[model samples]
Target: MDSTSGPLSGIVVADLSRVLAGPYGTMLLADMGATVIKIESRQGDDTRAWMPPVLDGKSTYYMSINRNKRSVALDFNDPEDLETARRIIGRADVVVENFKPGSLAKYNLDYATIAATQPEVVYASITGFGTAGGGALPGYDLMVQAISGLMDLTGSPETEGFRSGVAIFDVITGLHTTIGILAALREREHTGRGQLVETNLLSSAQSGLVNQTAGYLLSGSVPERMGNEHPSIYPYEPFPTAQGPLIIAVGNDGQFRRLCNVLGIPGIAADERFCTPPLRSRNRTELRPILVDALSTNDAQSWFDLLTEQNVPAAPINSIAQGIDYAESIGLDPVVRVGPAGEMPGIRHPIGFSRTPARYDLLPPDLDADREHILNWLGAESRLAAQSRA
Candidate 1:
């Protein structure tokens, strides 16, 4: 891989959004070598102070996605600061923002205005719902989860309407923003001009749940959350053992037969009730207890090991921290370094590109850290002098 010249090396991103979704998108670009100038307001992004577990007095959440980018805190509420914003956007190759639909318009920094000046700039917008009905409301992860029927499918039947602990919609939505920007950049190659790219949480969430949505659409029944059970496959959920429950994914008839072989009940594979995936699924109520009884002979890891060795998709239920650790130990290196914060470590970007892997592990910015530098870059005299120097 040409590490120094990954796909987005010369691209410049003016990140005008705050919090998760927008930041996540820009972080993807930053990782790919885009020079992202994260423009924050005077108070900074609201996430800056949102910390229960602070790292060196800075919010970990704020630092999570701010790596590898320069910070220029411009107060958009002020005319002078607004001028600063225009200057940065004027010089950018790409601009990403998630202002409430009308908010950035009042500042005359909407896509139309941006394209009028930087004709070839890729203007990406992230919204919660969209411009019409949801244009005025604030974009939030939890809100999207609730409104998009995602929360309806997540937890146990008794604890229905549950949401995932992590911000699934936000992360996926950010990825969609990244996709839009990349697609726009590709499109610009032919059009020679920028395009208005829009991505919303609702659309992202709907697409993210493609399989579930397909099942619901095909069956005409709202899928029920069976606490970890597979919606389409049988014996593909948690089965209790002496240590804990294990999730064994018997994907096909071969794996199902092998699972039966593991339990010394290979005859079950020949039985009419458990001969095929559909038959096994129909007999899951009877099969589940039988498998659980066999699985109860060992611990989670033992089952995991046996299943894995036989090429079966099986794992013990692990906590989030354990999962990260597991990913790291296997050379996945999930957590990234975001400079030293009094010995506290920074988080990593999850996206891994073979040709252009993300390299934005720099320190997250402090408030207004790049004011002077940004002001200098935006200065006409400075640009002229810099051009002369070049």
Candidate 2:
């Protein structure tokens, strides 16, 4: 990896986590030029088997978050392999793992053991629940979503609650883990020591709930599923247009007035029932038909263009392909080529640093691809010690 420019240059990370959350977080660090050594099991990370979306018979799911990392497969049952893992951790500036609490203790790879010798190592632990009462529970994203009330809040009121189309909580937890790790690294500079940074999917999911969770805590009201309709905002959901559904998000009175004008219903904005946000939300049943009828006058694309020109936030719902195309059309540059030859395409890291931008110099490794190089590097120190004794 070219670790000469990005902010995390020279920082070495021992990545012991796998699947989504932990891999996602470490990927972010790798993008910023952290030298991440992904220590996988003999069979490799579980995502390596999450197929059906494969590139050249390799799991794209595994490739997505494994870029810019060097893979070293080892079996903890083998003393030599375990020693290699320890040597990697001992030389790392940061260590990230998501094993169940106490699981790594027997192998002496836990935080307490690592910190005993390397007090300045920043260690991060990701879990499904917390380390306390829910320590033993498996930390999967779907389980966290169900347990965190997110599933209860999704879907239409007439239907049973639904899980999000993607692993939303896992992504959110990964982001939280990244944030915590960065914060701990920053603190280490001032304190001259590192501490354990912990994150759980359930807690991240609740925090990601944001306003919905706040509403219940502040008002003593349990929010029910409203489908796409937001609890606090009116004209926030999709409405039928001539061609299809168009989403009109009128955030304030000014936007509402503009939307009304664009829909050719100027009188509706001033109507007492829809004058204010709260009133509009309370009287959505009456307002929905009015907006839907007006929006129906034009095709969804036409209305989207007109409403956007008038400063009313409107959009035609897009598919994943359309979403990426739209981003590219708007010059967002959402994709980048990875690997030494830049032959593989991957999603570009979202952050843009002015002075030190993210780099994509390495490809996702095949299982244990870097074993020879890593073994040689590890052996170098042992050779130096022997030479000194001589």
CA RMSD of all predictions: 2.9, 1.6
Summarize candidate 1's per-residue lDDT along 85-168 as a digit string, tens digits. 897888888999998887888888999887877799989889999899988878899998988888888887888678888899
Specify the highest-TM-score model's number.
2
Q: CA lDDT, every prediction?
A: 0.82, 0.92
List ranges where model 2 is wrong by over 4 Å: 381-390
lDDT of 2 by residue, 1-390 (tens): 344577899898999999999999999999999989999999999999999899999999999899999999999989999999999998888999999999899999999999999999999999999999999999989898898999999999999989999999989989999999899999999998998999999999999999988999999889999999989999999888899898888889999999999889999999999999999999999999998888778899999889889999988899989999989988999989998789899999999999999989889999999998777876885788779999
The TM-scores, one per candidate, come to 0.92, 0.97
TM match of model 2 to true structure: 0.97
RMSD of 1: 2.9
Instruction: Give the TM-score comparing model 1 with the true structure, all chains together.
Output: 0.92
Clashes of 2: 0
Looking at model 2, residue 117 earns an lDDT score of 91
